[model samples]
Target: MRLPPTFYPALHDRVRIALDRAGLDALLLDDPLDVAYLTGFAHFPNERPVAAWVPRDGEVLLLVPDLEREYALDQRAAARLVVYPEFPGERGPFTVLADAVAGAVRRVGHAPSTSTGRVAALAAAFPGVEPVTSDLVGRLRLRKTPEEITLHTEAARIADAMLAEGARLVAAATGPDDLPTETELAGHVTRFGTAMMYAEHDDVVVVPMLTGGLVYGGANSAQPHRLPTADRLRRGEPFMLSLGCAVGGRFVESERTFLLGEPTAEQRRYYQVVREAQETGTEALRPGVRCVDANRTCLDVIRRAGLARFLRHRQGHGIGLGFHEPPWVADGDETVLEPGMVLSSEPGLYVPGHAGYRISDTVLVTAAGPRRLTGYPRDLDDIVIGA
Candidate 1:
């Protein structure tokens, strides 16, 4: 996984700028994506603690556990590699990191999500070092580089594949071999998505955010976030799915409502409303557009249709290194859209006793217009199967 040639150097410069602007000498990063954004090392620290130190004017130091040494070295994101032993090593991991940072530490900023012990260690190491929380990492990563954009675009392809398979499985309801139980089909989608992802980028190890998909039908479809159940698919009802696939450690959302058989007139009406709402959200996406407007556009259509109550949650979310990021498209979020910012355009509706419908497309905001990277059609007719 080779990072762009200028990625590291440019990021270091930005780090210095962020540090200077914050009136801090250095920023310590513990969040995996924060570190990856700067140094290209995307190791999930989990229980094993890892810290990447970015001094205002020196080489970056990565204090990582011994287990991640090989992977860390592969990325070459850090200058001084401080490899500490496992948890029960001669010295505590935090202490070792403190000793390293204390050498030339002053006022420093850190990830707010850092563990309490780690934050305390840093505070103790540099007693005079004023501690402060800064979302500089997230802010800096908000606008993606070209490499990042390519990674996200590719990830969206996997989502498209997953959606395609879901449509196929549901469309072939009558064929026993083609039809799979809700749980079984969810598993198949995961396996198939995994296989397809590996095929696209064999060498790159992509950690999928989640394996099992949300497969619900009949009464369960009424629940917005319900997962797959053992109940089999039934004709004349909506088969909804929220599937996923990842590439380059990035993910995108591809959610669509499926109709396994001929749908009822009511179902068609609801589907059309939701699909139009989703389009409104996507069409509203562009550089310089307000996130609030984008979100409102999605709901406004439903509101006009007198189904606004069924429109739950925000319209969408920012997509990048993680599935969900900043600048959510919802009420009161005055964030302005910018070129290269990828966001999901998901708008849905549900009635507890009736079926539900939603369509999510991972959209890329561009100067010209919004590009829907996840290319599955959202039209009610397109999604209708087994007619």
Candidate 2:
């Protein structure tokens, strides 16, 4: 699921534009994703720092440990290699890193993720060079390229399949006693998704493209970020599953809340409200629409149902290399939605002692309209198990 080779050249061209606009001679990126975004060097991230140095008018430089030289070359990363002996052999990696920037580059821009200590050290190492902190790469990543969208579409398909498998597992059970525990259910769905990704795409990278999620049953579902437990599913309670997958560093999310059996009237009403909210939010995604406005439109549905107090979070946020990126669909953010921006449509309702209801799908803002990348069914009947 690697991006087309041509994608890197175009991406660097855009980065060069950003650098010139910022009045920077070059940019230093240390965040793992930012580094991978610019250079396609997807090594396992750890305490050992990996950085990408992109000069406005020259080739990109990937600074890594000596141990990773072969790995970076094997990946055919799109940059010149700048290898340091080890983390702290005789001199620290940062000091060795100064060799790349010293004398040759001045007025260098560092990513926002660069630690204050590292920034101070880099500054001290290169007294003549000015280190400016910028969001040059982060801003560029907000919009997906056509090639990125293709990978996102594939990832979304795998996510939808995971949800389908999870629903099947629930449906196979005749009653609460027959239901799998929360841990078992999540494990099964994730394992199935991982297997499917490998089987479906020869280009998928195992180290970087792992797919997984967790399930929350009954009252546990009320919290948006709870871990799956050993508890079994309860009849007449809500079950929530949120699954995400990545292909070639592109990502998407698909989620749903299901009723274990016949739902009570209150449960059905809550479910309907949230489902309507998600659909409304998805539809509101379009060119020139403000993110905050889309968020407000989604919240209106819950407010109309007199469940405004139950709202737990914003409509959603942008999705790409990072699971949660900027251009947030929340009150404070006013970023205008543009064509090629990919976001999640997740408007949820949480009642502390009862349950939480949410349906999230990856949506692409396009000239025609908002297109859903994850094609899983969201209707009440489609999600109700053993009904």
Candidate 3:
């Protein structure tokens, strides 16, 4: 026995159980994250329709492009690797897939990430079999396994290192035209973390680091998700640094609001409010708690500070193989919190045209309660760049 990696053997068992419980004969996994979750078949999904037909009672069959055959075999993630030509003559990928899907099962289930064309092809093959969309796998994935948590913890460690580097870069800026422009700083953070990410690949299956989209100072920092610009660090404004990366297919996020010169009373107030809201939300990440309740817990802090109108988005979302996964932290989501579920506790205040202050961290709901994975400090003194 090779001793399966990334918990694939255990994950497959869960999928099979889900299939039986839901009366599904087979699960046709196509989402890159889902595929990686089930088979550890890591490959970037593109125009090609790569899929894994995991039957309830048999070995997993991975359908891959001829180009990916070698790696798929080397990894030995799938029980049986099925290779499709780059360009099939008359028998295309669809025809081949139909035969695989039609081999045993009748009730087929597809993930949300599945393509319309792939589903259509399946329908064409079995006209009476209507492939239903099941969140069974998604729900199963919501709770992270211990091995998955190990990967997430490593991802958080990488995020913390990169965030520390970003804060240092901001604090070390001597003048406006320093070595790192805002965009360059973003690249530096990503480049540094990516190098480490690949270096850690010896012990794990590392994915590309998803460098948190860095936004520089002043008005740019005020807009959440703003693209980095050539703008230099402003003296009186704050540089909101957000950083994230995936280690071994697990993702983690870290963020901080940094100020160059001393922050004015108003700037300090904004930063304090955002920080308080973040704490309030993080405190609620316990098993049995509702997802929306956690968001409100964070929101209430801002509401009391009378910055409620300034809040632009939900508190956060689940973080794992995907940056944003299920169980969104919002007012409408009623999903209950469970141990092993990982989420981001990020509450922000964005004052359009002036500045945006955001603090985010990956939080894991455990039996003992919430545990903050990203270790970057959120204190004003810790993040303040300039003296």
| lDDT of the candidates, in the order given | 0.79, 0.88, 0.81
Candidate 3, lDDT over the whole model: 0.81
Regions more than 4 Å wrong, model 2:
101-103, 207-209
lDDT by residue (1-387, candidate 2, tens digit) is: 998889898999999998998899988888988988988888788777788988889788888998999988887898889898877577767677677653476798998889997788777766678999999888888888999999899999999999999989889987658898999999999899899988877866544647887699889999999999999988889999899998888889999999988889999999999999998889999998999999999899999999999988999999998788987998889999998999999999999999999899999999998999998999999889887
Q: Please list the residue runs of candidate 1 whose C-alpha ends up more than 4 Å from where it truly belongs after superposition.
A: 74-79, 88-90, 175-178, 208-212
TM-score for every candidate vs. truth?
Answer: 0.93, 0.97, 0.94
Model 3, range 1-387, lDDT digits (tens) per residue? 122464676778888988999999888878888877777777877877677778788888788888988978776665577777875436667567666653556788998867787788777766677798887889988998888788788888988898888877776767866736688888888887877766755645645445555757788877788889987767788887788887667788888888778778998899988988898899998998999898888899999999888888999999978998988999999999999999999899989888889999999999999999997988887777676
RMSD of each: 2.2, 1.5, 2.3
User: Per-residue CA lDDT of candidate 1, range 1-387, in tens?
Assistant: 245567777888888988888888888888887777666677755878777888888778887888889988776654577888897477777568667763566688988787787788778656677788888888877777777778777777777788788777676566645566779778878878877776656557445363336888876788878878888877777878787655666667788888877888889889988888888789999888899988888889999999978866889999887878887999999999998888988888887788778888888888899999888887777988887
Residue 36 of model 1, lDDT score: 70
**Deviation in angstroms for 71 in model 3?**
2.7
Q: Could you tell me the lDDT of residue 218 within candidate 3?
A: 84
